[model samples]
Target chain A: MSALLDVQSLRVRFRSLGMLRALVTRTPDPFIDAVCDVSFHMRRGETLGLVGESGSGKSTIARTVMGLTPAHAGSVRFAGDELIGLSSRDYKAYRRDMTMMFQDPVGSLSPRLTVRSLITEPLRIHGIKDRNRRAEAKRLLEMVGLGEDFAQRFPHQLSGGQARRVGVARALALGPKVIIADEPTAGLDVSVQGEVLNLLARLQEELGIAMLVITHNLNVVRHITDRMAIMYLGRFVEQGPTEEIFHRPRHPYTEALLSANPQPDPDAQLARIEIKGEVPSLMNRPQGCEFHTRCPYAREHCRQVAPGVSHAGEGHVYTCHYPLNT
Target chain B: MTQASATQPIEAPAGAVLLEVRGLSLDFGSSRGRVRALRDVSVSVPRGRIVGVVGESGCGKSTLAFAIIRLLAENAMITAGEVRLEGRDLLTLTPRQMRDIRGRRVSMIFQDPMTSLNRVLSVGQHMIDIQYRDKISQADKRRRAAEALTRVGIADAESRLRDFPHQFSGGMRQRICIAMALLVEPALLLADEPTTALDATMEVQIVGLLKALQGELGCSILFVSHHLGTVAELCDDVVVMYAGEVVERGSVRDIFKRPGHPYTQALLECDPGRIHEKTRHLPTIPGSLPDLVEVPQGCIFKDRCPHAFERCQRERPPHYPVAEGHTASCHLLDETRGNHS
Candidate 1:
């Protein structure tokens, strides 16, 4: 089947504010390449995981696809229609088919709105009204594992888990085919995280919606996604089947990332394959390969020249000079 | 996290007991009401070992840590308990005395380094504050400050010392905090969710640095965090707290392998990292943490526990011994007690 959403060479850059800032500053224009030439696609009813650190631009990619963040270059084709430069009038219609679940549940939700109104807000925007919207709200609440009793409660009245449930319900209000869950389980209690993840997984299966799960959590991606992409320094370093890439990562960065994730089992012996130092700021990113500074196997060529994409067996492909052993 | 093993006799598990908290109970008297944050919470941090305190938010994990250093909010008061550091009760210490012990003996690294470290102050000034009690020369303070920064792996320590807190990245700022905390070489360090704000990659780096530094420095760390994976990785001993109570306490291996308490078991299962066999529904505790303001009379975890019975709702369950030095608070263990009290 044809791809549901196709993103090609998507580049999102944020300049150091505009207008008033430009008038105040004399230094050369500073910009961070939030998403640098990232490309991927998702089939109908498929789940793709985007794994990266805070400044790795996974969030930028999500926002770019949603047309919320204007792109510097490239195309976001949703069902063969270009999302870039879509007029404000057309963007509203485009939004009906795709929705994003934000990271902060407490901040993302309106304090004044009850669960019913929060869920129904999307429907109301699209002109659906009255009793049907209320019925749909109750259905959405139940869909996310909340009972009808939750519909009347305000955001403050609900717990963190309940607020997240309402967030998911609101995202599904428009019956979107594509769901972008941006760190959906972040800031949640471990037990509550499991519940929300389980609910999202269950709903994805039942509704058959294509989802782009963006998170720093490797475990979440491992459990939920069909395919995965590992982003580093705003670039997609690796992309393949979740199992293949995880079991035998072809990229040096991916290997380090996988090993870096602390396993819950106390008996598990950890290998010291961690990358040293924090993620580099986008402003002062490495010259050639973004990961060369941290990559254990980096050579002289790796620092001066960016590695090209090397295809492995099956759908596995990674941009690494010396790939990890299978 | 910072507690003495109050009711239990000090088995003294091969390491010198650095900090011992006994019968620690804390209450926050708000306009809403008095909320009992900690209930007879006891923990012992052995010398040179990292003890992990794992629990959900508002589970009194931070409250217990802050209370040990006597840095709780104005509304909060330590109603009962004693925190003994080196056999001396800290609860009885005055504010001035407590301030002296706070940085010199027991230093705390909060979750956010940005807020904890003064925004306007240079990284070097923070070190001088800690060394204020000592009549060290300005040069010595600067030299020692740079030395501490270098120890934590910050590049160009001399130049970085001039940089403000904002100039440093999240990971770098955290390193500065750790450096400043360990500047005077405190006997014990109380880290309250130090890496929660950091990214995963950054977290591992910080954890590694902490482990390496702890090994070299030979100082005990009372690391409190909600991330079970991180806790398991860094800690030798694990204390699982729920609703202001120590539901389970044991060696990391014992807790992971044979979690006796239903809450601990549920928590272990709930971690996404614990997924061995792929399944649609991840096992959850099924309920939120019980309200702290008005704690129930019986077991605090009874409402969410699958194994809880009528007896669990009626009477509070005391900690029952399991393996050597391992104990779990549960009514189910009462059967193993052979009907004894």
Candidate 2:
């Protein structure tokens, strides 16, 4: 199948300091690249996970794909239509086929609006006035496993899980073919996190909609994603089938990240590879391999020269001078 | 590392009791009414062992930690309990005596490092301020502060001490918090969700540091967190709390391997790490926690338990012994009653 949503050579940059401040400080470069040459594609009904630490540009990539953040240079095509440099009016039509669910469930919803109005706001935004909004709200709520009584409730009255369900309802109100959920199970208890993950899984299976999951939670990524990518300082360190990467990761960063996650089973043998130091600042990124500063297997060559793309197996690729388990 | 170990104050014998709470029940007088925050909660931290109190939000895990350090809110009333440390009842101590014990004998690490740290103060200043009660020289105190920072894996400890809290990253700030908390060489450390605010890599670093520090310092830790995987990895003993009550208590192996209580079993099954298959639906506990404003008559988890019977609905279940040093407050384990439905 052809790619449903494809992003290639995507580069996103942001102003780290004002021009005046940069000139006063004698800084040569004011713009910092949040995302650098990241590429990925999703077929119809596929789920792709973007995994990274904080400030690794997972959300920036999502926003850039949504056209909310302007890209420095890239190609974003959805269903054979190029989305880059499109006008707001022209983008409105794509908005119906691609919707985003924000990270904070409660804060994303307007406090003053009732659940009925909140869910149907997308329909109103697209100038769809023919359908009954109250009925539509009920349908959306039912789709998210919420009862009809929740239509009259405000955002504050709902729990974190309930608010997340409402957010899912709102995202589905437009019947988007692609849903970009940023941390769908964040700020929820273990049980509630399961409920939300299950709901998303069932929804994807039922509607056959492609999903782009952006989260740092590896367990969530492992459970929901078919393909996964690891990001370091906004660059794709590794990308492959989820199970293949989990069992046999080629990149040292991917292996360390998987090992760092605490397994619930106490008997699970842990061969943890502890990475040292903190994530490097985007402003002062390392000269060569961005993760070499923390990588355990980093050598002198890795510090002096950037590594090119290396393939591990079918559909598995990593950028490392000496990939692990080769 | 050698210098820090030489200054260890007390070497309590292994397997000796350090802090014990017996039948602790607390109530908070709120505008909505008196809310029963904790009920008959009991836990013991043995010398040099980490006892984790695992629970969800509103489970009174944090409140139990505060009650231990005598830092409860103004309106919190401890109706029934005896908090004993080193075989002496701490509940009978005066405020002045309690103040002395707080930092010198028992220290705490809160969830958010930003709120706990003073923004305007330098890291060295905060470290020096915490040692006001010590009678050591200024140079000795500074040396100890730098040693503590170094022990927690912070590079350039001497120079970074001059930097402010904002100068450090989230992981470094939390490392500082851990360092400061352990500087006093307290007998018992209360870490309330210390790594919840950190990233995965950072969380691993912090957990490793904590394990190493606890091993060297020989201080008992009452680690409270909602993350089951973390508790399973770091804690030696486990106390599972639900709706302000300890529903199960056992060694980490016993609790994780053979959970007797239905609530605990359900909680373990709900963890994404435990669910190995890629299924359309994940298992979940169906209902919410019961209200605690009024004293509950039946079992706390009766509403949500899958194995709840008539006996559970009519009366509260006592902590029934499941195995050696393992107990669960569930009627299903009551073989004497023979009334499990």
Candidate 3:
């Protein structure tokens, strides 16, 4: 089967003002490479977990794939159709087939709009002038586990979980084939987070919609994601089946990330691997591999030269000079 | 400090309770209505031990922290409760008395270090301000501030103290906040999600620092966090709060091994970390938290609790002893009547 979404050699760079001296001197502008040389693909009904730290370019990749931010380089293909060079009109049509769920539901939904209007706003924007929008909106709410009476309530009137359901309802208004959810359950309570993840899982199984979940929490990916990709700086350090990545992470960065996560087991003596030093700033990215500065098993070659993608197993791929076998 | 010094064993308790909160209830009063932020909450921190309070947002964990410190906003009123810190009633203390106790007896480190620190002041100035009213001289204050900064693992503490808050990274700023909280060597340190804003590596570092500082200072700590793993790793005792009420309280082993309350069990099952073998679906609690304004008369968790019965819906469950030093507010204890073997 063809991939639902395919990205190749994608890069995103932002141009910002340099130091005061440089600004006064009108020196050449410097660019910060937010996402660099990233490539991945998602099959239909498959959930790909994109795991990373705060400045690791995970959200940038998501935004770029959704066309919310234009990619500076590389191609994004959806079901054999190239989406990189589409016009605004064509992009609107493409957007109709894709949707994004943001991390903050309150920020995503307008406070002034009622739940009904918020959910149906996408359908209205897509020029679906049918009077059935209200009924469809009610159905969407019910699908996300909200009652029909919720249609009359505003975003502020709902709890965090309820607001997240409204966000899901809004995302599903156009019946998109793929959903890019960025940190969907970051700040929610554990139980509510489970509900949202279950909802997303059921939606994927029922609708066969491909999902790309971006988050820093490894636990979320371990449970809900079919495939997982570990991102460091602006690149994928490891990509494989979720179970394989969890059981046997090859990359040092992946190992560090997994070890850092607080396991729920009370007696499970977790030997936390403290990666020394902070993440290097994007403006002054280290030479060679972006993670080389913090990699525990970093070697001279890792500092001097970047590692290409090396196949670890049938479906597991990792980029590291010295990958861990265990 | 070297690894050997850092790895020194945390001293055993001196067998004295340092802080106790009993029957604490807080309500926010406004023209709209009264919102019960907390109800009949109680926790005790033995000296030289770490007690973790774990709950989701609006579960009143932070409110409890603020209430203990008497820093609650004007809209919030401590309807009924007693906060006894080392045998002195904090609730009965006047503003002037509380001011002396604030840093000298108990200090709190907030979640967002950036907002907690003064943006215009240098880190050194902020540290000095906390000690200004003390009998310590200016040079002594600077010396103590530098010592505290160095203790929290900040390299080149003297040089970095002159830098403003914006100059520090998220992890460094959090360390500064910890340093400020520790300047007076309070008997208790309340850390509210100190590592929430930090990344994974930084979080481990901060946790390690807190553990090391606890060993050095021998001060009891109330570590409030939503992350269960952190609780298991750092705290000796754990208090599980739900909807501003203590659902379960016990030693870390009992709470994790034999969680008495259904809400505690659901929370553990909902955590993604517990399911590692395969991609099993997480067991979500069925319903949302009850509105604080119109809380249900029965158990706060009855709506989402799978084991809830008619009695659970009609009358509030009392905190029953489940095991030695372990208690849970649930009707299931009644089901196991007289079987507390």
Candidate 4:
């Protein structure tokens, strides 16, 4: 089957300074590339994860995909239709098919609006008036395992987990084919985090909706995603099957991340690979390989030249001068 | 209400107890009513050992840390119990006395590194200012500050000290926080969710730094965090709290391998890292925490526990010995009622 969403060599840039300020400062390059040459596609009902630290441009990709942010280069095709440079009205038609769950659940919800209005607001915005709004709210709430009584309560009245459920209910209201969830289980208790993960998993399975899960938590990516991409300095250092990446990561960054992830088992021997130095500023990116400054196996060659994509196995690719597990 | 002797038989694990909280019950005057924020909570930090207090939000873990440091809010009332440090009751200490002991003897590492440090002051100034009580030359204080910064792995510590908190990254700021906290060489360090705000890589670095520093400094650390994996990895002993009560306390291996409390078991089971197989539904503990305003009469976790019996509702269970250094507060651990399941 054809991929539901196809993105090729996507790049996003944001102006660091105003035109006048840039002229005054004599800045040669006034723009910073938030995302650079990132490419990936998602098949129908396939979950893809974007794993990265803060300022890694994972969220920017989500924004660009939703047409919320403008992409500087490359193509983003949704169901065979070119999405870039589309009119706002034209983008509105695709909005029903693609939905985004923002990072903050409680903050994303309007404080004044009740849960009932919050969930049904999408339908009202989309002009889907055939169904009873109240009944529709109840149905959506039930789908997310929230009861009918929650409809009357405001966002503040709900717990972190409940607020997340309400957010899910709202996202599912329009019955989007692709859901971009950014840090869906963040700021939740362990038990509650599980509930949110499970609810998302069940809904994805039952509804056959593709997911783009962006989170720093490796465990979340490992548990839910089919295919995963590791982002560093706004580029995919490694992209492949989730299990393959977890079991045998080819990229040094991917290996460091996996090793650094704290396993719950106390007896598990932890030889954590500590990535030295802070994440370099996006405006002042490195000369050659962005991660060479901190990469344990970085050589003089790695410092002088950028590495191209190297295939490890079928569907597993890593960009590294000396990929591990060769 | 008789005093609960929860800390009676904590087998003195290898080292001497540095700080011990006994039957520490605290209440806050909330809008609704008097909220029982903490209920007979007791845990001890052995010298040179990392004791991790794990719990969800509203479970009073942070409050425990604050209470140990005597930094509770004005409305908070310590109705019962004592926070003893080195066999002395810290609760009875005067405000001036507490102030003297706070930074010099029991320093704290707050969750948010960005907000904790003064944004206006340079890292060097903050470090130098913290040592105001020391009767030393300005140059000597600055030299010592540089050494502390260097110990925490900050490169070019002397030069970097001139940069403000905003100049450093989140990981570097946290390292500075750790450095500042350890500068005093306090007997006890209360690190409340030190790595929660950090990224995965930074979190691992901070944990590793803490482990190494604890070994070198020989200072006890009370690490309070909701992250189970981090606790399992960094802490020597684990204390599980639920709705303001310590449900279980054990060595890291005992708690992870053989959790007696249903809450701990459920919590461990629900950890995404523990689940190797991808499933449609992840294990979860059903029901929300009990209301703190009108605190439950019996076991706080009874409403949510799957193995809760009639006895759990009638009376609160005491800490039952599971092993040499492990204890769990649950009715199922009651040998008198054999095989409650």
Candidate number of the best TM-score: 4
Relative to the unseen true structure, what is the C-alpha lDDT of residue A262 in candidate 2, on a scale of 0 to 100? 90
Candidate 1 Cα outliers beyond 4 Å, as residue runs: A17-29, B1-10, B335-341
The best candidate by DockQ is 4
Reference-based lDDT, residue A34, model 2 = 97
Q: What tier of docking accuracy does candidate 4 attain?
A: medium
Cα lDDT over the full model 3: 0.86
What residue runs in model 4 are displaced by over 4 Å at the alpha carbon?
Answer: B1-9, B338-341
For residue A199, model 4's alpha carbon misses the true position, in angstroms, by 1.0
Q: Write the per-residue lDDT of candidate 4 for residues A143-193, one digit (tens) a residue.
A: 999889999999999999999999999999999999999999889988899
What C-alpha lDDT do the candidate models reach, one value each? 0.87, 0.90, 0.86, 0.92
lDDT for model 4 comes to 0.92
Clashing pairs in 3: none
Q: Residue pairs in steric clash, candidate 4?
A: none
Tens digits of lDDT, candidate 3, A1-326: 87889999999988756578667977665677888888889999899999988878999998888888888899999988999877777888888778999989788889899999999999888898865977898889988989999999999998888899899999998999999999999788888898888899888899989999998888888888889988887888889999888788899888888898876666775576678877778778788877888888888898989889999777799988888964
Instruction: State residue B328's C-alpha deviation in candidate 3, in Å.
Output: 1.6
Error of 2 at A1 (Å): 2.0
DockQ for the candidates, in order: 0.74, 0.72, 0.69, 0.80
Give lDDT tens digits, candidate 2, residues A15-65. Answer: 999999999999998999999999999988999999998889999999988
- Sort by DockQ, top down from the best: 4, 1, 2, 3
For residues B1-341, what per-residue lDDT tens digits would candidate 1 score against the true structure?
34344346325588989998878998899877988889998889999999999999888898889888988789988777789999889988888988889888898899999999989888888877778877879999999999999999998999888889998889999999999889878999999999999988789888888999899999999999999889888898988999898888889898988999998999898898888665657788886777788888789998888777778888888888878989888878866534533
User: A35, model 2: CA deviation in Å?
Assistant: 1.0
* Window of ten residues with lowest summed lDDT in model 1 chain A: A21-30
